[model samples]
Structure formats: C-alpha cells, structure tokens
Target chain A: MIHVQGLRKEFGPNTVLDGINLDVAPGEVVAVVGPSGTGKSTLLRCLNYLEAPTAGTIEIDGLALTAGQETRKQIYAMRQKSTMIFQNFCLFQNKNVLENITLAMEVVQHIPKERAVDQAREILRQIGLLDKQDSYPSTLSGGQQQRVAIGRAMALHTKVMLFDEPTSALDPCLVGEVLSVIQQISQEHNTTMLIVTHEMQFAHDIANRILFLEGGSIVESGAPDEFFYSPKTERAKQFLQYYSMKRYQ
Target chain B: MNFDLSYAIRQFPTILSYTGMTLRIAIVAMVFSVLFSLIITIVRYYRIPVLTPVVNLYIDLFRGTPLLVQLFFIYYGLAQLFPIFVNLSGYAATVIGMTLNTSSYMTEDMRGALESVPRGQVEAGLSVGMTDLQVMRHVILPQAARVAMPVMGNEFISLVKNSSMAFTLGVREIMAEASLLGTSSSNYFECYLDAFIVYFVLSKIITILQNAVERYLNRRGGAVR
Candidate 1:
C-alpha cells in the first residue's frame, strides 16, 4: 500500500512536482505516462527518496517519511519496503548474475548466504535464467540483463515495486520478454506497483489505473480504457493524439 | 674507465646494500599514499561539504607544486617556519614528501575511476535497500578498483622512481648511495650505471606485478568495454 500527500519537488528555480496527492491500494498497478521533461521519473524517485521531496510525505508499506524530518535509517528502511527496477539493468559488473540476485539479501537484509542462494535459485528458475546464473551481465543481452534485474527486485520481496521505464533501454525485439516477465510477476504476487513508462499499449495492458502526467502534475487519471479513450484534459488528449499519430506514422 | 663492466658489477653490491632502505621508503609511501588518496576520493565523490573543498585544495596544492620543491620545503623550509618541525629527520621528511606528492596524483585517478561507474549502478544499489556505505563497498569500490588498476600501476612505478628524490633530503636510497660511491671513488660511470640497472629491473618487476593485479581485478569484468 502507498499513500502520498502534497508531494512537491524542485530543482534550482524550476518546480518539477507540484503539490501532488495520491493514494494506491495494495496490489494496484498504476502506470504514469507523460511526455518528456514531465515529472514521471521524479515523482517515482521522490517516493523512494532517490530525489528527496522538497516537501510532502511518502508512506509505503507502513513506513512514512515526512520530507524534512526523515533520518537516513528511516530512508533505508523505506527503501527496503519499495525496491526499484531501473532502465539500465545496473547489475553489479563485478558479480555474476546469481551474485547480483543474492547481494542485497545477504549484505543489506542479512539473509544467510545459503538461504539467499536458495532464494536466488528459485528466482532464477522463475525468470528462466538458471543457466545464465554464472554469466556476467555484459555477456548477456540487454533483455537478459534486464531479466536479471527483475530477479534482483523479486528476491527482495518488496511490497511496492517501482519500475522506471523498465523496457525503455531494450532493443525493440527484446522488450517483449521483459514485459511478459513483469506482467507475470504482477499477476503472481499482489505487490503494489508504479511504473513510469512510455509504452502506452503495455501500460494499458498491465496497469489497473493510468495517470497522465503533464507539466509536473497528474492532469488526468482513470482506468486504462477510460483514460486512453476519453481523456479529461486538452493536454492529455493532445498527448494521446500525438502518441497515436507517432505510432501509426 | 669508460663503462667498465667489472667496476659496475662491484658497485652493484654497494648499491644493493641501500636497496632495503629504498624499498622501505617506497613501501611506506605507497601504502600511505593509497590510504590517503582513497579517503580523499570518497570525500570528493560524496561532495561532503566542508571536506570536499579542503581535499580539493590539498590535491591542487600538491599537484601544482613541483615535487622537488615540496620535498625541499619539507626537509629545509618547514623547520624554519614551524618550531614543531625543527628536528624532523631527513628520513621522516622524505616519507612525508613522497606520500603527499603521490597521493595527489592517486586521488585524481581514483576520482576518475569512481566517476566512470555509471550513475545508475549506484542508484540500483541504493534502491535495493543497501546503505550508502554498502553501495560503495559492494558496487562502486570494486568497479572503481578495476578501472583504476592500469593508471595506478603507473603511479607505483613512478613512486619507485620518485623515491630517488629522497636523496636530495639526505636519505641514503639507491640514487643517494650511488652518488656517494661515485664521488668518493670517482668511478661516476660505474656507480651511475649500477643505479640505472637497479631502477630498470625494479620497474620491470613492478610492471609484472601490476599486470598480475590487473588480471585479478579484471577476472570478473573482462567483458566490459
């Protein structure tokens, strides 16, 4: 479960997230879609304190961080509750894939090594990368690397999974494999998810709710069908029209 | 007379006597330089407010001044300027000078290596619930070490060569011993040749060791471009 109240973020003289309030029920999958330079990524990052909110409160899985008063320990605990998947796959280059999946569990969470490996083996089996466990990330394709990244996030058992353009960095051909894995995970587990992505079709397919963000605020919000077909704001309508025109042509 | 092989061979034993002293200075300086520079790199990488600028000042000051001048100042100038350094031995000054000088170059190499790690890697570590220190330890440092290995290898060889400057401060290293032997025996060619051969052999040894360390660091990461 996640609750955000009056979230705001500023970079220098510019305001990025403007006094936004949101609530997500447990197991809800919310996809934030926005044109470039909008605060989709920033909003997701602020929830993790990756970019600290200039003001507001982020409460995830029973841990709440009010902007000004949160300590480092509190921030790390919150990070534990909501792990993130990055576009770049960011696997530790020094570790092979299995070590990548087990590192956070052993080091940060202090799960015993044998237990961590067993859990990693299960995740590797689920992701269908059990054979590639000994391979370093650079040896794998971008899609394979991203799958290992998903395995890393899955191993943590986090309550809220944040995906920031998970498929944006993949080759067009490789994107499907990763999307299917994410879809499968969303169905298998009831973890609440917020994905910031440009894949309109994938968002519609996977997300229960669509949040159309423009100019640093959610201009329109609804179920995927209603939001895609009948947007409330002119900007969102234009945005959808642009996306459609761009897609077809 | 001119480059007498037997004369040079005789001077080898004499030059070899001071090899231990030279190694002592190089090893101490290398260890301290490595420790100091790593700390500086971490401080600058994190941009720890007050300390960042202070270390930047240190790097700039040490790097800008010629190492010879720095050594001369430490051996000769500091005593005049500060009472605390009045009796600082030449041996102590030589170690201090080499450590300070080498660490400046090392800190830059380390900082560059750390920066070469993609920003996303650090964020990934953090998002997985690791603390800042854990991210540095498990993700950043190992990657940075691999990136730093080649250049740091150069620094070690240079540190060995740089230890020659210790002679100017009156520490009896290889160069100093050779000079003393040449002036007394007036066998300058033989004495200097002995020193040259030792330095050449030592650098070769360091290069081999460096290649071995690089292979170790690269063992896991040979595939990265």
Candidate 2:
C-alpha cells in the first residue's frame, strides 16, 4: 500500500507539486495523466523520493518518510519498498541485460550473486528477452531496452513501482511491445504501480483508475473509462480533447 | 648540427640501462596519481563538506605552478623553510611532486568522465534501492573508468617526460645519466639523442598498451556480445 499526504515539491521558487494527497492500494495500478509541465512526473518521482518533497508524508508498505523527521535509513527503506522506472530506460551501460536486472538484488537486497542471477534470468525470460540476456543495453533496440528496464524493476520486487513516461521515449512502432509487457505485468496483481504517461488508450486498457492532474493537483480522477469517456472538469476535458485529436490524426 | 651517429649508437646501451629508473618513477607516480585522483574526484563529485573546497585549492595549487618549482619546494625549498623536511630524499621528492602534479590533471579528467555517465544511470541505480556509495561503485565508476582511460594514458606519457625534471634535484634518472655522459665525453648531441630515442620508444610502447586496454574495456562494456 502507498499513502501520501500534502506532498509539496519546490525547485528554487517554482512550486512543482502543490498540496497533493494520494492513496494506492495493494495490487492497484494508477495512471496519472496531465498536460505538459503539470508535475505528473515530479509527483511520481516524489513517491520514490527521487526528488525529495519540500514537505510531505509518504508511506509505502510499512516504511514511512515525513518532513523534518526523515532519516537516511527511513528514506532508503522507503525506496526499497518503492522503485521508479524512467522514460529513458537507463540501463547501466556497463552491465549486460542480466546484470542490469540482477544488480540491485545483489547490491541493495544483499542476495547472493548466484540467487540473483537465477531470479534475473527468470525475469528476463518473462520479459521475452531471455535470448538477449548477455547483450549490453546499448546493443539492444529501444523496445528491447525498455523490456529489460521493466525486468530490472521487477527483479527488485518492490511493492510499489513508479513509472515516469515508460513509453513516451519509445518509438511509435515499439511502444506496443512495452505497453504489452506492462499490461502483462499488471495482471500478476501483487505490485502496485503509479505510472505517469501520455498513452491514454493504454491507460484506459491497463489502469484500474485514472487521475487527471492540472495546476499541480489532481483535478479529476475516476475509473479509466469514466475519465476517458466522461471527463468532469474543464481542464480534464480539454486534456482529453488535445490528446484524442492527436490520436485520430 | 654536429651530430655523431656512431657515438649516439654507443650511448644507446648506457641510456637504455636507466629505462627501469624512468619507468619506476612513471609507474610509481602513476599508481599514486590514480589513487589520489579517485579520492579527490569522489570527494568533489559528492561535494563533501569542507573537503571539496580544500581539494579544489590543492588542485589549483599543483596545476597552476610548474612541476620543476614544485619539486624544488619539496626537495630544496621545504628543507630551508621547515626543519622537519631537511632529511627529505631527492627520489621521494620527485615521486611526490609528480603524483601531486599529475593527479590534479587526472582529477579533472575523472570529473569529466564521471559527469559523462548520464544522470539517468544514477536515478536508475537509486530507484532500485542502491545507496549512493553502491551507485558510485557499480554504476558510475565502471562507465567513468572507460571514459577516463584515454586521457589517463596521455597523462602517464606526460609524467614520463616530466620525470626528467628530477635531474636538476641530483637524482640520476635518464636525463641525469645522459647529462653526466654528455659532460664526460663532451658529445652532448650524441648523449641527448639517446635520451630522445628512449623517451620516444617508451611513449610508443605505452600507446600500444593503452590501446589494448581500451579495446578490452570497450569489448566488455559496450556493443554486441
């Protein structure tokens, strides 16, 4: 489970996230959608403490971090419970696909190398890139690289996996491959996920709920179908209009 | 223009005898330079409190001044300024001077290399729960080391050439021995030519070894299997 309250993030004088409150249940997959520069990615990053919130309380699994009282141990413990995936698919360029997946397991989780390799191999097989396990990420196509990234995230087995534009950086032809992998993983129904994405159709198909954000807060949120088919707020309606028009073209 | 071809050929064996001395200076300095650069770069990379500014000043001090002046300060000047430094040996002063001077340049190279590893890799490492130290070890260093190799090779070659500065401090390395032979035979052209040949060939050998290392790291870290 993930719970956050009054999350505020600032970079210099710019307030990116403003008084955000959120809750995600175990096994729930939430998709956050918004116009550009609306803090969708910042919100996801705040959950994992990738960008420290200027002020907030974040609780994931049993780990907790609150403003003014957070310790390094608490923050890292929270991080171990929740991990973020990036749009860039930043696989360790020095490590092969299998090592990329297995690295955190060995280093952070302190699993033995042999056990981590076995688990990483299982994840690589699941992502349909078992044949390319020894290949470095730079040698793989963008689509294949993202699969390994997801596999890397899976290997950690964190309770909450946050994705920042997982498919936004992918080629149009390769987007489906990654979306399908996410879709398949979402069905396993153990890891809760918060994904910020521009793929409305994929969100509609994969997410249990849709959150439409504007002005640094959730302006409208509902079941994906309801939010897609019947947006309540003007900002959300305009967002859908803009994205859907681009989709049809 | 009064070159002595036969005399120069005879001096080759004498200068080549000191190849080990030149290499000992370069290799020892290279080892110490690498260690100091790693420490200084990591300290600055993380922006550790108090130490970063101190390291920055130290780098500027070594990098801004001449190595010859630095060797003088340690070997000759420091003895006059401080009673404790009176017993410092010439060989020790040369090694210390080279290590300090070389690492400043190397720390700059290492900083660029470390920065070249994309910010995304750091985020990926942290997102997976690796601590900052773990990220530096497993993610940043390997990639940065690859980026740092070529420049580090150049620094090592430069150190080999700069080791000649030790001759003025009464240490009998390549240039010191060459000067002695030149004085004894009055055949300065011949003896100096031998020193030039030795330096050139040693640099070539280092280039070959550096290329081999680059190939191995490139093969292991990048491209197809």
Candidate 3:
C-alpha cells in the first residue's frame, strides 16, 4: 500500500502540488489525468522523491518519509520501493538494451553479474525485446525503448511503478505497443502503479480508478465508470469534454 | 649553398634518435595531464565548496598565460625563488609546464562532454535507485568519455606538438637535437626540415590511433549523437 498526505511541491514561489492526498491499494492501477502544467507529472515525481515534495508525508510499504526531513537512508529506502518510467524513454545511451536492464541490478541491488543478466534476459523476453538485447537504445524505436524502460523498472520489483506520460513521446503508430506492454504489466504484477497519461481511452481501459487533477489538486477521484461517465466537478466535465472533442477530431 | 636533399635525408637518423625523448615527454605529460584534468572536472562538476573557486582560478591562470612563459617560470624563475626548484631537471620542468597547460584545456573539454549528457539520463539512473556516485561512474562518465574522445585526441596531438617548446629548456628532444645539429653543421634548413617531418609523422600516427579508438568505440555501440 502507498499513502501520501498533504503532498505539496513548490518551485520557488509557484506551487505545483498543493496539499494533495491519496492512497493506492496494492495492485491497484490509478491513472492521473489532467491538462498540461496541472502538476500531474510533479505529483508522480514527488512520490519517489524525484521532485522532492516541499511538504508531505509519504508512507510506502512501512517506510515513511516526511517532507523537508528525509535522510539519505530514508530517501534511498523510499526510492528502492518505487521506480519510474520516463516519458522520453531515458535509456542510458551508452549501454545496450541488456546492459541497461542489468545496470541497476548489479550495481544497486548487489545481484551478481550472471544473475543480473539472466534476470534482464527474462524481463526482455517478457517484453518481447529478446532480439534487441544487444541493440543500443538509439537504434531501437521509441516504442521498443519504452518497453526496455518498462523491463528495467520491472527488474527492480518495486512496490510502486510511476509512469510520467509514458506514451507522450511515442509516435501515433508506436503508442499502442508501449501501452499494451504497460497494460500487460499492470495485469500481471501486483505492483501498484500511478500512471500520468493523456491517453484517455487507454487510461479508461486499464485504470481501476481515475484521478482528475486540476490546479494542483484532485478535482475528482472515483472508479473509471463514474469518473468518465458522470464527473462530479464542472472542471472535470469541461476537461473531459475537451478530451472527447479532441479525440473525435 | 644550394639546397641539398641528401643532407636533409641524412639528418633523419639524428632527428629520429631524439624522437623517443620527445615522445616520452609528451606521453608522460599526457598521462598526468589527463588524470589531473579528470580530477579538476570532477571537482568542478560537484562545485566542491571552497575548492571549486580555487580550481577555476587555477585553470584561468594556467590558460591565460603563454606556455613558453609558464615553462620559463617553472625552469628559471622558480629555481631563483626556491632552492628545491634549482635542482629540478629540465625534463621535469618541461613536463610539468606542458601538463599544467594541457590539463586546463582538457578540463574544459571534459566538463563540456559531461554536460552534453542530457539531464534526463541522470534522472533515469536515480529513478532506478542507483546512488549518485554509481550513476556518475556507470552512466555519466562512460557517455561523456565517448563524446569527449575526438576533443581529447585533439588535445593530445596539440600536446605532442607543443612539446617542441621544451627545446627552450634544453631538454634535448627532437627540436633541441635538430637545433644542435643545424647549428653545428651550419645546415639549419635541412636539419629543421627533418625535425618538421618527424613531428608531422608523429602527429599523423596519433591521429590514426585516435580514429582507430573512435571506430572501436563506435563498433561497441557508442551513443548516437
């Protein structure tokens, strides 16, 4: 389980996340949807201390961290419980696909090289990237690179996986492949996931719950059906109307 | 007084004799300079408190001054100022001067390469739970080295050629030997031309080796762009 209380992130005087609170049950898939600059990415990044929360308390699998008061030990402990998949498929450009997956396992987790390679190979096979094990990320397409990124996160077996607009950088033709991989991972693993995405239809399909965030606050939160079909707030309805209009066009 | 091709050709053996010494100074200076550059780059990268400004000033002072002046200062001026420096060998002083000058430039090259690696890469490494040091060693530096290879190669070639300046300190390297042979034989043009050929060939060899290393790195799937 993951619990966040009063999560607030401020970049100087501008606050990105304002007193946001949410809880995610283990194995739950929650999609954070909002317009750009609404703090969707900031919210996810804060959970893992990637963008340190200005004020908040995050409790993940028994490790608790208070904002402005995290020690190195606590930060690392929190980081170990969560891993992130970036929008741009931030694969280490210098490493091949196989080395990318094994790097953290060998260096951070202290797994033996042979065992790490075996684990990486298994994940690659799972993501259908076995053939690209030796290929550099630059050579791989965006979709394939994101799958490799997914495989990298999975290898860590974190309690929570954060996706920051995973499909945002992919071409229209390539988006489906990466989305399917994330969908499959969400179904198979008991890892709790917080995905910030603009792929409305995919979010509706995969997310057990939906969070409608606006102006650094959750405007509405409910099951997908309720959140999509009968939004409680006018802002969410307006946001959905724009999304539907854009999708139809 | 006619130009004598045979005399120039004959000067090859004498010039070649000192090739080893010239190469020795350049290689030794290159090794130490590169090491020192890495230290400076890393210190600057982290902006280590008081030491950061000191390193900046060091780079500026070394880079701002001419190499010849630096060599003279270390070889002659320093000897006058300190008794220990009076015993410093000409070879040592020359190497020290070259290393100090080259390392300042190398530091800037390395720092640029390190910065060229996108910030996203560092974020990705951290997101996966790798420590800051691990990310630097495993992800950042490898990629930075790839980007900085050609520049570093250029620095090395410059170092090799700049070592000719060591002749002023009487290190007896290629240029020094050529000067001696030219003055003694009164055939300045031929001996100097021979020295030029040696320097050119050495530089060409360094370039070839550099390209070969780049090819090898590229073959190993170096990052694109």
Candidate 4:
C-alpha cells in the first residue's frame, strides 16, 4: 500500500502540491486526471522521490518516507518496490533494449549476465517485444519503445509501477498500442499501478478508482463508477461534459 | 640544387621508424590522458566540496597555461627544482606534457558530453536505486563517451601533430629525427618535406579512424540527435 499525507511541494515561489493526501491499496489501479499545469505529474514524480516533497510524509509498504537520513535510505530501498515510467520514455541512449533492462539488475541488484538476460527476455516477451531485445531504443517506433521501457521496469520486479502521461509523446495511432501494454500489465502482472493521463476512456476502463486534481490538489476521488457518472462536484461535472462533448462532435 | 626524389625515397625507411616512434608516443599519451581526464571529470561531476574547488583550480591553471610552457616546466624547471626528477628523459617529459595538455581539453569534451545527457535520465537512474557512482559508470559515462568521441578524436589528431614539439626537448620522434637528418645531409628542404608528408599521412589515417569510431558508436548507441 502507498499512503501520502499532507504533501506540500513548492518550487521556489509557486506551490505545486498543497497539503494533498491519498492512499493506494496494493494491486489497485488509480488514474489521476487533471487540467494542464495542474501539478498532477509533479505529484506522481514526488511519489517516487524524483522530485522531493517540500513537506510531507509518504509511507510505502509500511515504511515512512519522511525527509531524514534513515527515511532517505528507506526511500532508496523503497524504490526497488516502485519504478516510474516517464512521459518522455527516458531510455538510456547508450544502451540497447536488453542492456537498458539489465543495467540496474547487474549494477544495483548484482544479478549475473545470464540470469539478467533471462529475466530481460521473459519480460520482453511479456511486453510483446522479444524480437527487439537486441535492438537499440532509437531503432524502435514510439509505441514499441514505450513497451521496451515498460519491459525495463518489469525487469526491476517493482511491486508498484507509476506511469506519468505514458502516451503523451506518441502519435494518435500509437497511443492505443502503449495503453494496451499498460492494461495488460495491470491485468497480468498483478503489479499496483498509478497512472496520470488525459485519455478518459482508457482511464475509465482500467482504473479501479479515479482522482480529479485541480489547482494543486485532488478535489474529488472515488470508484470509477461514481467518479465517471453522477459526479458530485460542479467542476467535475463541467469537465466530464466538456470532454464528452468534444468527443461527440 | 635540383630536388632529389630518389634521395628522399632512399631515406624512407629511417623516416618510417621515427614515424613509428611518434605514433607510439601519441597513442600512449592519449591513453594516459583519457584516464586522467576521466578522473578529473568524475571529481568535477560529483562537486566534491573543498576538493572540487581545488580540482577546478587545477583545470583552470592547466588550461590557461601554454602546452609548450608546460612541457618546458616538466622538462627543465621541475627537474631543476626537484633532484629526483633530474634524470627524467625527454621522452618521459613529452609524454607527461601531452597527457596533461590533452587531459585539460578532454575534460572539457567529457564535461560537455556529461551535460548533454538529460537530467531525467540521471533522475531515472537514482530512482531505480543506483548509487551516484553506479549512475556515472553504468549510465552517464557510456552515453557521455558516445557524445565525446568526435571531439576527443580531434584532440587525438592534434596530439599527434603536436608530438613534433617533442623535438625541442630532444625526443627522437619523426620531426626531431628529420632535423638530425637535415643537418647531416645538408638537405633541409628534402628532410623537412619527408617529415611533413609523414604527418599528413598519419593525420589522414587518424581522420579515417575517427570517422569509423564515430559511426560505429552512433550505430551501437542510442538515437542519433
């Protein structure tokens, strides 16, 4: 389980996240939706300590992730349990897909080459990229590259996977391929996932719960059924109607 | 006096042997310089507080001073100041000079490459539970090396050409040997022309080698651009 409480992050003068709180049950798929520049991505990055929270406490798997020596060590340790997928893919340009997957395993986990290669192969097959194992990240298409990124994360054996606008960089036709891989991971791998996205229908389909964030805070959250239909807040009602209307015409 | 093509040709083998010596010195200097530069770059990359400032001072001093002055300092001034270095040969001084000079330039090349690697990638490495050194070795250096190769290759070619300066310190590399031949034969033009041609061919070879390495690394490494 991941528990976040009183999360406040300020970038110099601008406060991006203001006293935000949330919990994600193990194996849960929670999709966070928000307007542009609403700090939704920042929130997700903070969860992985990619961006340190200015003030907050994040508890992952019963380990406190407060800002201190002991907590910092635990935060690094906790990273083994969680890995983030960036909007930009962030694949190391120097490595092929196999090296990218196996690097952390070899260096951090100290896994041997044969074992790491075996693990990388299994994950590549799972992500439908077995053929691209030796191919450089540059050689693959955007969707295929994203799948390789997912495979790299899976090779880490993290209990929680975080996706930050995973398909934002893809072409319209390529979006579905990447999303399907994410959906498959959610279905088959049993790894907990938290996705921040703008794809409403995809989020609605895969999310166990949905969070709607506005002005640096989550204003509404609930089961997909309730969050999708009969939204209680006027802002939520306005957003859903606007997006749905855009899709219709 | 008419140009003696046969005479120059007759001296070819002697010139080739000295050319071999020049090549050996350049290559050895490049290897040691790259190692030295990597250490300086790692120190700079980590920003090691008081030590980093000192390293920065070291880089600035080496870069600001001329290579000839550095070579002279190593060969003449330092030996005078220190009795232990009294017997240090011209070849050793040339190697030491070239390594230090190339290291200063290579440090900049490497620094540029390190900067070119996106901040997100470093964050990604750290988020995956890698230590700072691991991120540098496994992630940063490989990528940086690809970016640094073309520039470093240029440095290497320059280093070879600059090996001529070793003549001043009495090293018997190509240029020095040519001068010796020039004095003996009383044929300055032919001897020097022979030395020039040797440098031209070596530089051309270095260019071909640099292009091949750059293309190979690009193909093997990540997305070009």
Which segments of model 1 are wrong by more than 4 Å?
B1-3, B76-89, B223-225
- List the candidates ranked by DockQ, beginning with the highest: 3, 1, 2, 4
Question: List-wise, what DockQ does each model earn?
Answer: 0.69, 0.66, 0.73, 0.61
On a 0 to 100 scale, what is the lDDT of residue B221 in model 2? 59
lDDT at B66 for candidate 1?
Answer: 97
Docking quality of model 1: it rates as medium
User: Interface RMSD computed for candidate 1 is what?
Assistant: 1.3
Pairs with steric clashes in candidate 2: none
Q: Write model 3 residue lDDT over A13-56, tens digit each, in one string.
A: 89899999999999999999999999999988888778889998
- lDDT per residue for candidate 4 within A3-69, as digits (tens), equals 9999989999999999989998999999999788888999888888878888888878777676443
Tell me which residue pairs clash in candidate 1: none
Residue B93's C-alpha lDDT in candidate 2?
89
lDDT of 4 by residue, B92-200 (tens): 9999999988888888889889999989779778877787677888888888888888888888899899999999999999999889998999887888889999999
Selected candidate, larger lDDT, 1 vs 2: 1
Model 4 CA deviation exceeding 4 Å by range: A68-72, B221-223
Q: Best to worst by lDDT, what's the order?
A: 3, 1, 2, 4
Candidate with more favorable, higher lDDT: 3 or 4: 3
For model 3, what is the C-alpha lDDT against the true structure?
0.92
lDDT of 3 by residue, B101-215 (tens): 9998999999999999999999999899988888999999999999999998998889889999999998999999999988998889999999999999999999999999999
**RMSD (Å) of each candidate, 1 decimal:** 2.3, 1.7, 1.4, 2.0
TM-score of each: 0.93, 0.97, 0.97, 0.94
Screening candidate 4 with a backbone cut-off below 3 angstroms (N, C-alpha, C), the clashing residue pairs are none
